[model samples]
Target chain A: MIGEMILRNVFHRPVRTAISVIAVGVEVMLVILVVGLTSGLLHETAKRVEGVGADLMLQPPSASVFMAFSGAPMPIKIREKLEEMKYVRAVAPVLLQFNASGGLDIVYGIEQETFKAVSGGFVFHEGGELSAPNDILVDDWYAKAKQVKVGQTLRMLDNDFHVAGIVEHGKGARLFVPIQTLQELSGARDKASVFFIKLTRPEHTAAVADELRKVFPRYEIRPLKDFLSLMTSSNLPGLETFINSMIALAVSIGFLVIFLSMYTIIIERTREIGVLKSLGASKGFIVRALLSETAVICGIGIVLGIGMTFGMRAVLTRVFPTLTILVTVDWVLRATLIAVVGGLVGASYPAWLASRKDPIEALSYE
Target chain B: MQNAATILAPAIEGFLPGEWDVDLILKTDNLWKVYRSGKLEVSALRGVNFEVLPGEFVAVMGPSGCGKSSLLYVIGGLAQATRGHVLVDGNDMMALSDAARTKLRRHKVGFVFQRFNLLPTLDAYGNIAIAQHIHGNGFDPHRFEVVTSMLKLTDRLHHKPSELSGGEQQRVAIARAIINEPKILLADEPTGNLDTKNSEIVLGMLRQLNRDLGQTIVMITHNPEAAAYAGRVVHMRDGVIVDGVPED
Candidate 1:
């Protein structure tokens, strides 16, 4: 009955109801979009790092320090030294650098045969495998941003290289090059920037890191998961702060809009409220009726907002290609919980006003 | 002999005492209602003593600002009197908790507003059914038919308040009021919003409800013609009862 009454009243004032619904929907959509973009960035960055299947990365102490803000150089020989250990299954050497566009990029020096093992069987758009020493594989994002195609030669760090293939991975920007070619181009003798180590299994990875810290006291042996988290969080604090602030702002707006809408509705229907009151409706009943109206309005807005999120995903992707806005089940759950809380918060003020209305005063109001 | 006594009792005596006797359904002693706005305190009801009996139709008549509606609101438990005591169905309103007073108002007293305060969202039947529902009682559909038919609303059960005429809406309000079988029915100018035709229709139904169903009704009205329909009339001025004609 409360639902029916709310539905009827909602339609009775179509213009006001629509405005209120749109206001709520816009706020909800903003929150969903911001959260989706932020989490997508984090997930994509992690995916790119996970693509290598390296249990841990060994970098020069200062190399780990500047890895987030800017690329730093480590000796090219760290990979060879780590590979000699019996516990180390394989060591994929990598050199870190940045393009002229200021986008940080990884230059991996992967063995022709062993590159397949470290690539985690990732699909390449053009090339079947990493074969030529001077050929480079670039991610679609980097390739598109640079406007480079297969067989296009580009000079980096005084060495010219050919774009052999285009690679696509979840949300990560990467460019792969052969080990000898990266080593020769960078002009670093017997020195590798970073060592990507694949341990025997999950259990041996932690032990290997512990063992590496003891053996090579000068380098930082960071597990893939922890390293990426620290790097991303440290690198993107501004975006994270902005998203957090936006969430609070959106929720506040949702509460205010919903509350005012319900308040106006209750005030306009004073006679109806009195009738309900005089009909033996407890204060609890009155409060529930008003809140149910709020929930219904907000629920409709949220459903529309969710639909809008999906419909606009393509546009969002086009706007920021690096962002992987994957609408996972968890995100949907979070949005639902946030929306429900927002609806409840919005209804609280109006419910109080409704419960406090004197049936006589209300009956007399209109 | 019994039929003769029963007929004579109501015509001459104030009321017959029975299990459903209306006498003392509501009692107020020296009730006062003072409104304080900033520094000025105006008295709306100044020590008015009143009693409404069961199975009696009483109209409270007074000019504007004569405290007629204030007295009704006080007696109906909708407002708290500034001073003095109000007792409804043996419950002292001043002493009862807010929740208890709310319950007393809910289960015991029925209210009809001058505006025909029917829920606009509900149809006539829906409005009537809500009373029982709010009181946590299962709706007795049979009683719905009896009350609605008594008010001449049998044909307009499904019509919302906006769709119905003022008279029909007032009738639905009355049906909703009496659906719970409340001990007292308080109508504040139930015909105030109706035209002569609709007013007559509503007043006629209220009179019939009192005479046939033995329901107690207390109406606040300023119109002499509307007040004349009641079996007894009470006049108020400055929040005190100026005159009251006994039922005899």
Candidate 2:
């Protein structure tokens, strides 16, 4: 019966079936997009934090914010004190200053070789590392925007530096410069600000951050994970509220759409349902058949939506090198569950209405 | 008439006489159905007393709105009669819950509708096969051959309802109705949708089902020609059974 309901009746009416498919598809797309974008944003921001490769952020006792806001910068002495701690694995210091060509941006500076381990791909796109004290390694996006390439000279801080290598980082905006070069050029007050520390283990991160904060009572110390959330939330307004509202809106709208579409289908198939009822089909049979159709359409929509997400991710990352969309298993599970619930919830009204129809009246219905 | 009634009454009540044809197959006594449309009480069946024995062929003839169909419905356990009792195969329909009525409908009664109401999605074979599947019984290949051939549906078994003629679809509907070998066959205007030629063909198959398989058939139709095919004809008007006549 499932096979017959799924393949024969569902596939027979290509138009209705297509409409069902589209309904399911839209539901799936909405769920996947919501989960994908939110999760992707979270992942991408976290990746950026990890790109700084910091276990904990140690800042100026009074002036430093634990989270890296757009303008606030830690002083150099804080880094010196943090490095002096025995638990600190290694300390890589960075100075950040803003540059705005179109929107807000950040220019980061760190020691050439240590910056390699700290910033990872923040220097050269390929093989070579950040070597010259006066040379800069910017993100590929910024390089293209500024049209600065290797051997080309760019000016900042009232000084010029060779474009060393276009690099990539998980956090912050686009620029990477040598620590000595940025200090001389940007004249950033007390240039050395951030200390990116690779922690000994998971248990040591909070302890180390707490110990660092105690020593620098004026500054806030935070684990990189917490710092990343702070950075992302500060950039977006009412982050939790916005996400909750969007999710609530999607779910409500999804239920309404699914309900109406499925209801219309049931109304259209009233005669067919009557025929089934008259044919000794139990109510359970009809219910199962309707649910089976809903499940199939929902499944189709989920697959299509997920596929679209991956496809869009490919295009997005290609077009905007800075936009990294990450899809995780949790996102897939969440999207699929939403699709199913939407389908089932959507199917509820129609199934009940169909079942409530009197077999004789439905048969007589033209 | 006496001979037909004698033959049919036994089939209607089987060998047992005292239990009101409960196990005999389809039975109803003092069944009253009142249709209330916002305080307008229209009595469709006023204490309809009726019975059809196993393998008996009966026809109901009546004018429009006479409630012949309602009688069939109440007996088939489709509609709940407002008062009195309905029993099929010795089971009290009114006393039993809705679920039990449905079970009786599934296992004991097979219905053929006026519209030749075959499920459009299923082909002729599928329509017949679905009954067997629903009953949790294996599809008998020999039974399939027998019924389809009897209905002259062998050539059309694979065709969908749209592809079949009205008569052919009705025949498939009949095939579906009897595919379960139900105790009682209730057909509502089985020939109403067919042309004369097709009507006769449907009537012919039904007659054969009655004669050979002893399948009890209660058909509701206004056509005199259709009524003539039945071994017994019951005339209905305003929900009352006016006459129970056995046709020779």
Model 2 residue B14 CA deviation (Å) reads 21
RMSD values, in order shown: 5.9, 5.3
| Per-residue error (Å), model 1, residue B1 | 21
lDDT of 2 by residue, B1-248 (tens): 22212222223221222344333566677889999999799999987777666778889999999998888888887788899887676667786566666667878889998888777888899988887777657678888898988888999988999999999899999999988888889999988878899999899999999999999999999999999999988988888888884333
TM per candidate: 0.84, 0.83
**Model 1, CA-based lDDT:** 0.75
**Local accuracy of candidate 1 as per-residue lDDT tens digits, A184-209:** 66666455666778777867877888
On residues B135-156, what C-alpha lDDT tens digit does candidate 1 reach at each position? 6666888988899888888999
Which has the greatest TM-score? 1
True contacts kept of each: 0.63, 0.44
Which parts of model 1 are misplaced by more than 4 Å? Answer: A62-72, A87-90, A98-124, A127-136, A141-148, A151-164, A168-172, A176-193, A198-207, A223-242, A318-322, B1-22, B245-248
Q: Candidate 2 falls in which docking quality class? A: acceptable
